[model samples]
Target: MGEPQNPGRERGLDIILASRAYDLGFMSDWGGAGNIISTLYSAKSTNFASTWAKIETKARTELANELALFRGLE
Candidate 1:
């Protein structure tokens, strides 16, 4: 994907969304550290509850992708 117009500002926004996602993830006891971190980094701050949902979905997708090969071996 292409970078934002202002990468520095976009990075700051990512950090803000990440912190929020981390708190939500911790409170919910969801996913492992890698998933949590990935969700945080990938989250977009469109809204509060919706953003959490997005993070959860992203985390689950990432986890499934990571384990897809193992699952297929079953």
Candidate 2:
């Protein structure tokens, strides 16, 4: 008899994606706080929106690649 395949193994990607998403979310939230602090202290505020957009785009691209790989494995 062949060894039983563990269905839970496929969920590893899902866990990774979820963790990445959470980190991105937290970064955005913290960035907002930084922007507010800079404004309050009369400090020059950086353009975090553009930087975040670039990061988000990259994440989306990577997520697509991961999905493709997962699909191919099925």
Q: State the lDDT of candidate 2 residue by residue for 1-74, as single tens digits.
A: 98789888679878977776444333443434323445535645476665556455555666576568779999
Error of 1 at 17 (Å): 38
TM-score, candidate 1, is 0.26
What lDDT does model 1 reach? 0.58
lDDT by residue (7-32, candidate 1, tens digit) is 58979988998886345434434344
Clashes, model 2: 0
Candidates in order, TM-scores: namely 0.26, 0.32
Best by TM-score: 2
Q: Give the C-alpha miss distance for residue 51 in model 1, angstroms.
A: 6.4
RMSD of each: 14.2, 13.1
